[model samples]
Target: MVSSAGFPDFTRVVSKTIHAVVNVKNFSKKYSNQFDPFDFFFGFPDDFGNNRERKPQRNDIPGLHGSGVILSPDGYIVTNNHVIKDAEKIEITLNDQRTYKAKLIGTDPSTDIALLKINEKNLPFIYFSDSNKVQVGEWVLAIGNPFDLNSTVTAGIISAKNRSLGILRGETQSSIESFFQTDAAVNPGNSGGALINTNGELIGINTAISSASGNFIGYSFAAPSNLVAKVIQDIKKYGTVQRAYLGVKGIDLSKTEYLKVYNQETHQNIKSQQGFLIGEVFEKSGADDAGLKKGDIIKSIDGKPIQNIADLSFIVGTKHPGDKIRVIIIRNKQKKIFNVILKDLQGRKKIRTKEEITPSELLGAVFDPLSKESKKDLGIDYGIKIKEIRTGRLSAIGLEEGDIILSINGIKMKNPNDVNKVLKKYSGDVTIKSIKENGQVYIAGFEMN
Candidate 1:
């Protein structure tokens, strides 16, 4: 498809895919008290000069603008979670300039993908391509809105695969970072946009750019479509991602310096220059059940070569609990193959529904919104009561029954649902402000990761 001048013609791909890319706007919940031009130009209220905070109505201005891809004809849209994160309202504008309010269906912070639904029907959508077949140097197109420019299209080639830049650290500690690296000119407003191949098939979702000056520096990353599809399907079916865990902590052998230190500390010379070296295998984990152990080097999965942690993570991430994989590893310089079954976070082999995986169930506790009488007694307007504590994170952290949860990581817990929302999306640096059963204030901090 390369033209005479050596440029692959992008006309056909852009024409079909551009229409499915929509503009996403995140509206702020409250307006700032900063000097308002309207108030400055007109007569102010008598209390304008008072040193008090006023809860203003919703702001009309969008706090952030990004691009999203329409994934289904019946109004399913997909975009980066950060694009609409914390927004009081989400607005979607189609290519025809028809705007509609979008409802957030679900979000998977680990993948940075969110599912949205609008009321309209019979819309254009993009089809998912086999991202596993996407190769380096393949021609591709980046379609999105950048700096308010609608339906902008850019051309590039896949520069690399299975790249992990740790750009998703803010999303979650268990973040999946395997991405397709490209030089596709993605910019500020391109997050949640489409990264399609020359055949007009969606290969990835453009998520982040690696740059120091906040502009494209010939490096952009996308969450591969294979993983995106799995996440979307889970969200649609279960209202949350059915994340599977391999539960093995290890070091990538490709990093020579770290490998050398590991070799010295472990008192062994691991000469292999590539693959992931297992440092610890959690008990009762899939890897442990499959007979995988410490000091083993993972060489492949289902015959695909494992070059680093990214490769291993990506292959495992695309699968759900109860899925089986063929894993090959090197143990004592001898190759060994094992059939491994993945497990969910609760170390179960069955898929869990939203109710089964609730924050209360995961934390081994029961929560309820603070009673009116309790709120009046504590002189607090918001708190979630831990009605009972079982063997979960709360109990492990010393929180007991009748404890009141005021906040986590600075976010107020107004109800049990608020606690679920925060815990579902966040990991690492857990700080909980609560009240003990004795009416004394209590706070607990720990590293969840």
Candidate 2:
């Protein structure tokens, strides 16, 4: 007799989710043609000449295989960015061994979500759940193809949320992190898979795991479906994800104890407390244009208390460019309200395309204007010497303070404006050739996100 005093049965839910999961196999081929004198003289088994009665054997190149969930019945699927990154070919195999070639629609490296399309109709798909309502310790399932071991499913509860592992992708780092942490056994081949609730609704996308030997070590992270949905919608409509930016630069409030000495030295009477303190404001930026000055403490955004840098980032990220909102700040022990119009980090009213790189957008190292003294010290005629590395794209790439940028992609950069112009013309990877004071040349590559 079957026992009736058990928890709710979830077998049917797992069965339905399994039908929507598919195994992705990426294929590639490499051919080598070279003349070997020793082999020709010794009578080799295979001939290298084109006229010979032999053909090159087909080489199977196994790429980073993973899993994907069918998002729609018309064959729209969702997967991870790391799974199909740099893949020359993508093949999707169903549970029935039926396979088809998939086309890449879009990818967001910051959240590690990718959209793929295939030519099919009426396919089984899964629905997304309200990830915001999912509580920690709730039952969830991680479905994927681990180690090529077809369609494996592991069950666990949510461990934590809003995790920052410092995983970066090129020049774009995810400032909005509300990850659903779980102890699911996610592995290499399971990168682009689904994390679902007991109701079979997709809540998160399995992305990474914390392991020492490349195996599961009781820690895994997933991109929340809320963030995933936004990135997918943006990529599908505009071919890229657009992010809203706050104009002020500030350190995390939790580290105020260690920064008291520096803060006191910079501004007298400005107490180092728990909140985002404005360090520097860009000229004519959204915050600057709204009369926000340095040394002001950001108390909250739209009535929500500002906790740290990430908290402010998350609140700002939810808004779009040109959206107006009220910001509460504490300046000199006085509470003041300011109405600020949000803008993209570049102080632009809208998101820019591939051909727009302004001086403010080139956030990285600060360059000193061309002067006779600077030119004599750096031994460069038509280049700007790096003065201070503030905050921006270059600082994330390990650009030091004394590194002098001679040219960008072979175009001589005379000043910061010239460097921005050269960078704006190119859309993909841009190379920077820098020279040190002691004459050591190093190459750095920057990719636009």
Candidate 3:
């Protein structure tokens, strides 16, 4: 993959992208807690009750290394959310050996993207290319500080397009995993590195790899640059990600997972060649408001064919709240298109302003009311399911992501607002009854602040 005459020379690309790739360090001093009420959310528990008799431990995170890509000359940098999650301090080292502390602007854990800013100006940055236009088998380069080796470059061809590895589920409930798969030799410390084309345009962010031995195994994935660009724009415009939702839970028609849904809903034999079928729709959501029913099959979005969840995410994930989307669906052997105005998770159109921001807004989580079928299955009449948890007070309180909140201080929790309103108003010990992913019900108490 060297530069040569009469061909796409990658040397020009390496020269342009290498300057924007930088090393990232996450510093934290909190001691790791030894608890696992819910095994998934906390790598280690965030809290261990009010006991203060334990001895001080070393920093939970120190000298943790990763990679970042510069997005602007004014020092705006983009990296993976996991790279900076729970970081007490962040440091960025440029290729020229200049180091500066970075300010975390905001993060979209759903997309596994984070935006950081530094005080420096006139910094080298990279331009984003239309990831949609990137074809499979295109020449690409992965640049990062892999294995603490700064300014490392690896070359490969894009092996596949629109890949979903279910990597983002743990960080954000609304996982968007439309990744571009590559054979580049990515490894540890390459989480937020740049994936660029031969033209020197950023095509994706090198994120994760599929390896059985904890290293690259000829397969890797990257968050598309188009989505990263949209995430960056949202962080700059809104304080947090203004994720617009289609609000329906279903399965891809081609997968075996859709059989259970098909049996339960239609009670018919598994038979479908194409189109995504809806199993349930959230109330008051754009899909529900647009008259999209559970039995409907999604045909396309904005004239683009919807082949799978990744395709759906690529289109809707880039849109903001209050934006209108045209959804084409097939219902009872009829094709229909509905113009739907996407709304925030709260089913509202208002965006949070700086002055109006509150702790609830800072609570990076999404809450959905328990469906009747869900309540019946869980043997709970009232509760709210936490769809996802990014960061904020809820996460600090050890509220495991995706756990259901059954009650607040012995009061039945009905909807998302109840959890938000209580967390916003109460400042003391709050007891919560909830259901875990393992179907175990338990009670937890923690301070609101």
Candidate 4:
């Protein structure tokens, strides 16, 4: 809409959508500020070379604030997972000054999305638009709380799409990062806000801003609304994201270095410059079952052109396991079409049930493999860090987040799967040795059966 002065006016869109944008505050337990994974700045280092002072403060810590978008009248809200990570209490405040405590439904760190629920009805909600239909150079309004300012809205145009920044860290290490790059003014407190079109339809969720100063510069990124909807639906119905995997590893050929390496290693003179070159095809995977071999360049999937890794990851990340996808690849300069049935990480072709959760999952905690730097700093060779603590055995036993799991029942915790392998077979006594985030050693023993 344009005003009488011939300028684009977003007053109507703001009035319709701003009511659904909300303030999300996360309250965490007090602890020493010693390199918290959740306390970093948009997945970057904490200080960012600013040479900020590091001083000890009081034990009580104030709640951190962000933004959220209401998706349903019954109080289903969506926000970035990092906003509420490791939070003990989540508070939601509506635009009309109403507040309520929120319950965490589920989280998918791969896409950096989280679902929350509150007991409220007749609440205002935003409508979701097809993000695939969003085009560049289109006007968009960013609605969120920036610097604790409530109901703030900024307007800009979509600058780019399908951008991957390698910021998100998922459990499977295959993070979905197809972001809508915009010139909208998104900031630290706008992590989970809404990005709506002129029609007041939500096209994306404001996630991260590419700024060394930890504020809005010239560009910002948002998670596409289509991907967010699929993730939330899976979380609400299945208690987890039904992540599908094509079971192949490759390098983006658009880069000069990767292209050179592929041609030299395979002794092939391939000249394609913008397709994903297959490095290894896992055995018994959907790609292998469909006769997709190594050295094939994937040109397209389901008729959509594959330009790079971001294009491929975003397309497949939205699909569920057991879904068949049409894949077109160029092998020896000949186009080949293959009907590939996607599978889960477990190699299953069916939907997974909540009851099928592994023993480690039943503990109500998320575990990430400790980094090499962290291992060396803690003087431990192998351990898994407790990323988040929910309501379960670990939390009930007073185990806090950021505690390292060195070993369980005398078996070294090398990978996340190791916890499941050990606990599933033993039913007697259980013992866990670990180190706290403060460098204190802790050991606990309990009966399993």
Name the candidate that leads on TM-score. Answer: 4
The CA lDDT at 262 in model 2 is: 54
Q: Which of the predicted structures, 1 or 2, would earn the higher TM-score when compared with the native?
A: 1
Tell how far residue 209 is off in model 4, in angstroms: 0.6
How do all models score by TM-score?
Answer: 0.78, 0.66, 0.76, 0.80
Which candidate do you rate higher for TM-score, 3 or 4? 4
Residues 1-449 of candidate 1 have per-residue lDDT tens digits of: 66799978788778888999999998754333443211211223345564333445444488678899999999999998778754556899999999998877766667778788888889999999999999999888999998878898988999999997765664456778799999989887898999999999999999887664556778788999999999999878865678789889889888888888987898888885779999999999999999999989999999999998899889999889999999999988799999999998679997987656676564656898899999999898999999865433464344678889999989999988887788775545677888877776766554332
RMSD, one per candidate, in order: 10.7, 13.1, 9.4, 6.9
Local lDDT at 409 for model 3: 72
Per-residue lDDT of model 3, residues 1-449, tens digit only: 44456655677778888999999988754344442211221122236634323354444446467899999999999998777765666889999889998877777777778888888888889999999899988889999998879999998999998876666675557888899999989987898999999888899998887764557778878999989999888667755667788889887875766666667767676566566888899999989998999878898998888887788888888988788999899888899989988888878765666446564565666788889999898877888988866654355334666788888877788988886566655555566677877676655443333
Candidate 2 residue lDDT tens string, 107-155:
6555567788888998989998877688988888899998888789998
Residue-level lDDT tens digits of model 4 in 84-178? 76565688999988999887777777888888888999999998999999999999999999998999999999999999877775222668889
lDDT of 2: 0.70
Clashes of each: 0, 2, 0, 0
The residue ranges of model 4 lying beyond 4 angstroms of the native Cα positions read 30-60, 170-172, 264-267, 362-449
User: What TM-score does structure 4 among the candidates reach?
Assistant: 0.80
- What lDDT score belongs to each candidate, Candidate 1 first? 0.81, 0.70, 0.78, 0.82
Candidate 3 RMSD to the real structure: 9.4
